[model samples]
Target chain A: MMKQKNVNKRHLRNDILLIIVLLLVAATGAAYLFLFRGFGDVVKVTVDGELYGVYSLSQDRTEDISTGEDGRQLNRLVIREGKAFIQTATCPDGICAAHRAIFRNGESIVCLPHGVVVTVTTAQTQGEPDVVV
Target chain B: MRNKSKTTAFMGLFTALALILAYVEVLLPPLFASLPGIKMGLPNIILVFLLYRRSACSAIVVSLLRIALVTMLFGNVMALLYSLAGGILSLVVMILLRRWNVLSTVGVSVAGGVAHNVGQILMAMLLLETAELGFYLVVLTVAGTLAGVFVGLCGSALIRKIPANFLFLDK
Candidate 1:
């Protein structure tokens, strides 16, 4: 009986732990989708050591950077007024499309496969920095 | 020898079943609009079945082969990496859970599904080179819960029909 009870207790404890982990995972996602969506507003764009385009988040506009026919890959970054996003890339993943726009200090857009990055370096808010480095 | 052939055939069938299920799930609508990698993980049913009826080595082989074959046919090699990570992690978690005997088939299946999601997210972080991607974990976990329950139920039903002799065979 004692062994059975112990097993039951262990099972219960594991169930509780699973629930806690699930909640933690859910909470982290909610915090990002809700709280961190609008934390920046500056726009800067650079490509292959050259400035591509800069815009204002307050203003709505899109900038395009094109690679030359020489097949030389271009490095690019875009900071929109106060929000920063990936301005250009030649890498395959295109994961930058998923990055949150950077509006505060420490926010950056990096293409690891392409070795390109766009960083936001000003803190408009006094809380934790927006992007994960 | 005949028994060994039968087991091999069964394993192949299950692997094929998993591949078909994966393709079907991919064609379905997204579970959440913001989450790109959230999957129902229906293919995990085959893993659960192999766990209960076959050796761990067989389960691993089926998992790896299914991932490799499916990715080669319809997806990128990068996707194969994510599936490999998810499959290995989930298999380990299930193996550990199997030891307690306290977990029902459903419970073990749920654990595997959750582990799979966690593993995929970790791989995504490394591939993307951004920890900010961790934000997707929440969505993946919720999706995992639903998928876990579904796969768990399917696993339990599958185990009910498997013969005891087939489960115990060692050839």
Candidate 2:
């Protein structure tokens, strides 16, 4: 009986620790979602080494990028002068629509089904195409 | 050896539960326009419960079978791959942590959630053929943390209410 009690105590302690850790992780995630909004500010898109589209986040305009053999699928990207966002896509997951306008460095847009990427680069950094799809 | 029939029955039941959870989550509305891959991961509750009561091998088998069967029912092969990768990674992490005895079912579930996000991101990187997608890892991981906790809590509750002995009796 004593041994069983000790085991139960250990399990309880472990459970508490687990809850604490999970709370920490969830809190950190919430913080990131709230705090990390405007960290970058440039919009550039390249396809197969060719400059397909570029938008300034500061301006309010939308550009349509159609990629595929005959343009059967449409990938619409919105650029508000300095900010870039994916407005829509024909992909099944519609993942591209979830990306917000990125005007800062290290921010990007990826359409896996369509094989396209749009990235923001820092002004000070050399403009090498970050990704080609 | 005599318990093999019982084990099979338990596995079938868990598999059904997982499939139901997966279907339910699919019905939930998307959280945001900017978070397409995000999900509540309700099925993970069942996975976590299985992990604690059954052997690691059983947990892995269940995870794999659940993904395959659920995907087939939904007709989404891509989603299946993503789930499989994430599930396997989480299972490995939980199994390893189980050795230290520091992690409860919830902790292991959270770890598994993080692993799943990592696995999905890796697959995205590969499929898209671009390292630029790596930036999304941070967001996915952060989301994973929340999802993991929710699933972990659910798993803890489930384990308590339905004793493992009853569930694994057939096994």
Candidate 3:
């Protein structure tokens, strides 16, 4: 690796401008994220577009959620300390595993490859769509 | 004033540096690794350095070669796909921003850093067939921006020291 010598003068202005832009973007983005944060009480796990299981986030347990036709174990949904998260997933992306814990209503963790959707919902809105129909 | 052999040697050295960085990142325990959307983006420093000091084509080649070599040495198929998607997207953005010449390496690296995360998230969304990943981008954007700053500092410091050789830089 070549050594870095002195700093450039013109690049400084642009660098500062870039930093400003990035800080602004990050600030607005943080606001947007906080603005729409959820508050669900129930944790719902769905597999392959169908309802697989529903558990209360208030309780603590380890659930092995099997997905797809073969029913091979793909995700491990863990509920503890009043939050829900995927302890593990055998899927390709592991997006579900990467997700932070969810406890608020409307928060969800999705495993794309296995078609698993773990969502947090209020007791009132739970199954409202099917029941309304 | 530039020798072909020296240029070749620089290219090889950059490629090796990138490979080492990538490998080290993978073996760095699980702090950022377990966090999903969060990454240090240490390897990006070299890419940004090359983009500013060297030619974009060589930078691209080095970036792709680094990804391929790293994936082959220590990653799986999914990792390969993710690296490819992220590396290409990041390089493209950095090249464009650098060409604009309005932004500094910091800005270019920031764009590149954020683009890498965005690309990976998009690929994840496609594989998962869900938009909930959108929620994750908020965190990712923040993480990416911070990582970009770190990479920018390193790249800026390094690029500033390198002797100016206009061989491949002529564009």
Candidate 4:
């Protein structure tokens, strides 16, 4: 009985230690990501790794993003008040549509089924070459 | 022979329970509106229980079975991939933690939950071809931790209520 009690105590301590460690890691990461993030000026949309478009967040407009052959899939991206979000999507899950607007640098809304991703980025550090023919 | 059949029956019952829990979670609205992918990890409660009561092999088999059945019933191919990644990673973490015997069900489940989110996020990064998706992990980790604690509490309670020998018949 004494041994069992000791083992239980050890397990309890381990549990607390593990939880505290995980929480600490998460909190630190969050602090870094949130505190250092900057407001974005442009919304970058990509479809299947290809540059779809780069729209100024300052412009309030809706763009019809049609993907897939014959343009069957569609995700309506709306940029307004310097925030970007998917107003509507034809994807099954509709997760991206439900996602909250993103205006901070590196924030994104992803539609996995449609292979659509909209990211907010500052003007200086935007990757993916501008599609200029 | 009887014990073998009893074990099989128990496994089946556990699978059914996990499926019911998954369905229940689906029926409920998203836990956090801002966090689209956050879930209660309700099925994980059974996973933790099985890990403690039965062998890791049984728990793995049950986890895979539950994911497969859930995919066929309500999810698509993409969902299948995500579930497989998360389920396998979480199960592996839980198994190792349980084997170490340092932490009890709650700790094991907590690690499992965090690992699950990490696996899913990794898979998302790969499939979406976007490294920026990793940004979601900061918030996702917090959600995973909370879900882990809740599921862990339920799992420990379940472990206490259910006896080890209940799944096997004594000759």
Best of the candidates, lDDT = 4
lDDT of 3 by residue, B1-171 (tens): 167787677778889998888778766765564465366788898889888776798889899889888878877776777788888999999999888776678778888888998898787666655555555676677777878888898998888776575434432
- lDDT digits (tens) for residues B20-83 of candidate 1: 9999987997676544446788888888887877667777888888988898887666667787
Q: Which predicted model would earn the best DockQ?
A: 4
TM-scores, all candidates, are 0.68, 0.79, 0.78, 0.93
The residue-by-residue lDDT of candidate 2 on B1-171, one tens digit each, is: 267777787778888888898888888887655577688788888878777766677777778888888877875665676677777777888888776766667667777887888887787666655566645776776677778778988988877887646744424
**TM-score, ranked from best to worst:** 4, 2, 3, 1
TM-score of 3: 0.78
Model 4 regions more than 4 Å off: A127-129, B1-4, B169-171
Better of 2 and 3 by lDDT: 3
* Model 4 agreement with the true structure over A1-133: per-residue lDDT tens digits: 9999999899889988987887788788777767888788898888877778888899899999999898999999998999999999999988999999999888899998888889988777765556311
Kindly state the number of residue pairs that clash in model 3. 9
Enumerate the chain B TM-scores of all models.
0.86, 0.90, 0.88, 0.93
Candidate 3: where are CA atoms >4 Å away? Answer: A1-14, A46-61, A67-73, A88-100, A110-117, A122-133, B1-9, B29-37, B165-171
lDDT of 3 at B36: 59
Which of the predicted structures, 1 or 4, would earn the higher TM-score when compared with the native? 4
Q: Against the unseen true structure, what C-alpha lDDT does each candidate score?
A: 0.66, 0.72, 0.76, 0.86
Model 4 per-residue lDDT tens digits across residues B105-158: 888888899999999988888887888885678777878888998999999998
Q: Against the true structure, whose TM-score is highest?
A: 4
lDDT of 1 by residue, A66-114 (tens): 4455646554444455465655556565556555566653345644344
The i-RMS of every model, in angstroms, reads: 5.8, 4.6, 3.7, 1.5
Q: What ranking of all candidate models by DockQ puts the best one first?
A: 4, 2, 3, 1
Error of 4 at B96 (Å): 0.6
In model 1, which runs have C-alpha deviations exceeding 4 angstroms?
Answer: A1-17, A28-38, A42-56, A65-133, B1-4, B161-171
DockQ of each: 0.24, 0.34, 0.33, 0.70
- Among incorrect, acceptable, medium and high, the docking class of model 2 is acceptable
